[model samples]
Target chain A: RKLESGDAAEARDNFAGFKLIKVLNENTRNKCIFVHGSFEGSDDDAVVLMEKTPFDKQSISAMLTSTTDLKQVMQNDIYGVYTSSPPPDLNGINTTIIYPATDRHIMKYSAQQIYLINETAEEYQEITLPFIESQPFSLQWVYNILDKKAESDRIIFEDEDTDTGFILLPDMKWDEKLTENLYIIGICHKRGIRSLRDLGREHLPLLNNIAKKGKEAICTKYGVKENQLRVYLHYQPSYYHLHVHFTHVNFDAPGMNIGKAHLLLDVMENIEMQSDYYPKKTFTFTAKEKDPLYLKYKAAGKM
Target chain B: RKLESGDAAEARDNFAGFKLIKVLNENTRNKCIFVHGSFEGSDDDAVVLMEKTPFDKQSISAMLTSTTDLKQVMQNDIYGVYTSSPPPDLNGINTTIIYPATDRHIMKYSAQQIYLINETAEEYQEITLPFIESQPFSLQWVYNILDKKAESDRIIFEDEDTDTGFILLPDMKWDEKLTENLYIIGICHKRGIRSLRDLGREHLPLLNNIAKKGKEAICTKYGVKENQLRVYLHYQPSYYHLHVHFTHVNFDAPGMNIGKAHLLLDVMENIEMQSDYYPKKTFTFTAKEKDPLYLKYKAAGKM
Candidate 1:
């Protein structure tokens, strides 16, 4: 089927112009229809015209004015309707046809194009976050959600008091806060140890052995397929600390899925619970305990 | 001193010759040294002769000689040192010379140039292996060291008593003959109740938790700083199993000396001792436990 310039030109000349054009194939029986619309001169006079057509004997007929008109032709029982264009507005007949409306086709194609672009962008974001966080090395960091939430409040308490407020939580309450599917993996830089220089030189063999054994146990327990997991080590200079992170969301995987982020969080949570690699203690955050401290700020009108 | 190559009338005879020379310094050290070399020959020959003199000011004086004695000097240092020309007995003088012979300055420079070219190539092989192995999707097959060593003998035994011999000692021992420092992280693909897939899926969380706790425990136990410890994972695909490896090798950290391959083995051994996630079992591999049916083959040197 051909989309001739003449048909377009003819539509441009008339008002409620070219209603519908149908294309049909007689042999294999394929069909398509085109409808035109425009808002050239005044917006109110602009009209949209549609055509429902079928291809027969390798040619398409003039536009079918309505669904009923198209259905009437179907009584002959030929091929199916191949394509249809939107109907024209009967009310507007004086506006000059600016262009035959291909907005529907363009809109459909554009939507699909946009979806593909957005999908790739989202995947890129998911993959990049873990990598950036673990930068220079790819180590996962575990932060307690509750602790982060509390810290966000911007209360300046003494170190000991801060520990009491957050770290020294009751064990039962801590367990209660944990969900069934959630797990925690802790990253801690313990105080009072020599630098990495001393440890790697003197104790690398033993340290390496621990990491190896830990990895095997985790993999065996998780039911992850081979080559499906990635682990990175990142050194955070701010805390003068180094930590390692094990990740399941491999950026190199075929398609990045946001679901993998949730999976990584679950893995981190699990790691935190099973190992004593990080210290866990109970802490309380009572308003009464902190109110006296808040009153000092209130007196300064800073609360 | 400038290279005066226009024309020279030496000893009242018109002779085409050029003086190759250099000036040491402009003010404090205004010393001109005559570069004695043959100029009656082609540019290539001139270059060869000029190159024989060390460019260093400290050694240039020691290399200078009279231009008239070029043939004799060339005969002494250049002839027969590197090439055989005009027969070996021509005037009993050598025609070829080793360029940097006895010149420490030239020798050191040549050695440095050679080292720079070779160093990068050598490092490529050493550095790239770990990076490739660390890639998330890299596939590595794990074979029991013992299994590989006894492959030939096992094949022969299988031919004799196919079923009984194979089932009796299905698991191979670690190959001790291979001198490489290597260890196996045993990954079994169990089916039915606890399949390999199930184990892998469950293993990640378990291992993550173990790592979290283990890191703290190790820090406390060893009295090492928390930042000194690190964990990494690599998936071995040959086993068609999923496993996480926790390794403490910090390539960028100061003072890490273990080889990559050996470090991986050390990790496996550590996992065996430290990890609580795996279901531990003891198995014997004594010679006496060998199937009785294979005794005949053992005697025949087939097992």
Candidate 2:
């Protein structure tokens, strides 16, 4: 009640009602755990509550390998479901999946890649959209995607902004540059917040820091001039998690596409002009036929 | 003559009578200096020579910042163009651009991608062929792309069959992967060799070693199982360089397209079965309206 209207921190601390579900796959020897909690909504019958702690692959690994790992694994909890939900798929290939006793919580953003979209718009209506509509929302798998480097070491540097701890990861490709240049991955500690629309003015400092101080670090550490680095975010990212991509001007990385890439500074300025800049405007992103998300969008006639 | 016929190493050792140029910009303070030299050719009036070493940005920074920078700064090396010619556009952006005044020889290749391409046969012509046709045989630039980290520090592990050095770079995108698995950028030290098409039986050791030993190293380093790592090459790469991509089997990256990515092991086997496996076949890759190379291909009627 109080948490819903405005208090994000209070909402995070109150994780008493949710059930924690763990997903295990021995083939991967990886465990993906997701939060299962729900609350009644004004319009929708039941909406799942999402945690706002950004995933730490290292912590998850430790949680899976050891029984006595620390209980307080999350940095800060503050996530809530933002949109319409996808149904859970019962016919998952892995038999080790466990479901919470209450089957009404949690959801997934059916992710898709634009590059692999080989189907016509018509195909979207008939085939692709149906598959997405029918497919299960696999939140557990998405949770298990981060590994140790993300949590322990891949961090180039971090900053304190808007009462949150932000992480900086150098993309492996950027590290391989022939010259000392900037290619970085910026991650926020908040979890369950899927895309740019989730961000508010509170995130401004973190975004600006990376564009300025973070860029300066690249020059000192990699010896690349400050001007060479550009920091930006992807609208329809490779995944749903909120992360910023930083790269040297010269290296033509996969997501650096003009249509796809959005400069971080521009994002900040745009938000300043309009509090709900992202949500107010619709931007195009690439989604493939096989992606379950594609099917949902197609069925909605949004594709 | 000695440089092309049976003496790639010896030719590298003999450096005499060539002036090196450096490009610097003060406003942005970004300096991008390319090596420039040329000579007369056998058939065409003059053929320019290109050097084989890739640029080392770190080394250049060291040179620019300090006097006692221990690294060797490459200067005064002689290079001659090596094959058929592309008429140097007199209307180049930089007037200082000289046509092979020292044209001993020069050459080119066309490559493309399928994602941007929609029409079946039209794709084969417009987007695909043009990409292949106009790609600059910038052996000089490619040679300088590999830095020391790629050759030495970046190597996950080494094997015996390959006498040549192998470099493993982490993909810029892979840093975000949750698990500490193998998302590698594999580089070979053979300068002037553009892509897999340029590889031969003599390079077998390096290829096999990486697939076998490199895979093991990834498992040992990242705790990923052997089967989890996938090694591959991008046809008509973002750039013309002989580098292979390695990633976790679960990750669905941009170029993982069935029509684009070529498995390194499969490529090696294909080469063994036939010497010119890549050269004998035509494949597609992606290029945009903005790519200068696309313009060249369109003008040549292949696009």
**C-alpha RMSD over true interface residues, model 2:** 29.0
| Candidate 1 chain A: worst-modelled 10 consecutive residues by lDDT | A111-120
- As a TM-score, model 1 comes out at 0.17
- Model 2, position B48, has a per-residue lDDT of 15
Judge candidate 1 at residue A160 and give its lDDT.
26
lDDT of 2 by residue, A178-282 (tens): 653456777665566556755667667656766676666666777775435556788656555677776765544566533356667557765664566555343
Model 2: CA > 4 A from native: A1-303, B1-155, B158-163, B180-182
Whole-model lDDT per candidate: 0.23, 0.42
